[model samples]
Target: MSDEEYKKVFSKNLLHFLEINGKNQADLCKYIGVSSATVSDWCNGKKMPRMDKIQSICNWLHIEKSDLLESQSADSASYYLNEDARDMAQFLFENPEYKVLFDASRKVKPEDIQFVKEMIDRMSNQNG
Candidate 1:
């Protein structure tokens, strides 16, 4: 691989995300409608994906382009949040109305927002 492609391939965030989400090369091929050789090339760092396919992959993964571009220093970086955070994310995902309310609260006073954040933090720390 060229140095630039090397950077893209070895970051390993895609592999990390795939594993955490219980997928493999075959699964990824199915999801992205690519061949096994293409997926293998990606997994083995033999090639970098084209920019066109990058968007397709990101859209399929529900991720932004930046997630695929972590540096080599982050080869072992985590892609998924912890279980508690995942639970909270799923809660927000399943409750659009609640998410709307939360989003709307952005207009609330900063001090009021801080107080609510602190309350959640204290409760979470106690339970955690």
Candidate 2:
């Protein structure tokens, strides 16, 4: 990636993991022995850290370097069986109101999964 693109990707990933792990810029600064301003620059996409510092942050966050460096394809359907499954998963994560679908699905039979989908489709059709 170009330098600007690298900054944006790294900063986005850094902020994502920091929030996931309940960490803030101050916590990162103390751990990496950098000033708060330096951490802020990294978090805000103003600058990129050196390789050693990237390794340090990875160790601190218990994540692989690729997790910090690479942008996972949010627009692609490579991992899932299809695009709809991926879109549904993203929707479920972004909207906690539908969390019961997830909670209930865990105990549901594999054969019943399609039934639930059909039920949803029927309900949506009725509403539409």
Candidate 3:
């Protein structure tokens, strides 16, 4: 990819990660011991973080490095759910009523299994 496209994608991934985790530039700066301007540079695609710093941020967020670097990582992300999601998915598969939902979703693409699991869990909570 061109450098321009790469920068744009990098910033997009950074922004997406922050948004999903309910974090802001200030929070990231404080947590990662970076200046607001540095974070701003990252968010604006003007620069990328150092490898060590990127790893530190990933560790702090309890996420894989790919989560912040890859586009649409959520779509293909597997076994990356938190403990609660893991438990909820398991509970749903074991509950007969919810089992029907999973069986019906057998046609869902493998990449979308995580999305289906979340939706079904939400439905189960509502019905419970």
Candidate 4:
């Protein structure tokens, strides 16, 4: 790919991962030891990170270098119903601790799930 194309793909992937991971440019800037301006440039597709910095970012994000540098395929997984579901799957994959709740929900009835959610919301509201 050309430099511009590469930048576009990388920036898109970076932004998607950051958002799903509940992170921002500032978090990336601190973790990768880059300036806010540099992170902003990368996110805006104005520039690309060097190979070493790319490696650092991949390590920090717990993803592969190809995940950052290459375009992801739409049929990456066949199970998800749509893009949002796939994004949620990716989030669960990255954070396995939360996956247990998702897995448990699969075995629950709709009413039971709603009841549990309401209970949790009530508990949270009380605590807050």
* lDDT top scorer: 2
Check candidate 3 and list the clashing pairs. none
lDDT for every model? 0.61, 0.75, 0.70, 0.73
Which is the winner by TM-score between candidate 1 and candidate 2? 2
- Tens-digit lDDT track of model 2 for 79-106: 3344555456456568664544554322
* Candidate 4 Cα misplacement greater than 4 A, ranges: 77-128
lDDT of 4 by residue, 1-128 (tens): 89999999999999976765567999999998889999999999999999999998877766678878888888563233355545555555676644443543222344544455567668768999
**Predicted model with the maximum TM-score:** 4
Please write out the lDDT profile of model 1 over residues 1-128, one tens digit for every residue.
46766645543867865654556889889888899998887877767788887778777666667777654354453333344444444554575533432432212444443455567668768999
User: By the TM-score metric, which is better: model 1 or model 3?
Assistant: 3
TM-score of 4: 0.62
Quality of model 1 by C-alpha lDDT: 0.61
Which ranking of candidates, highest TM-score first? 4, 2, 3, 1
> How close is every model to the real structure, measured as TM-score?
0.52, 0.59, 0.57, 0.62
lDDT of 3 at 86: 50
Candidate 2 has a TM-score of 0.59
CA RMSD of each candidate after superposition = 9.6, 7.8, 9.6, 7.8
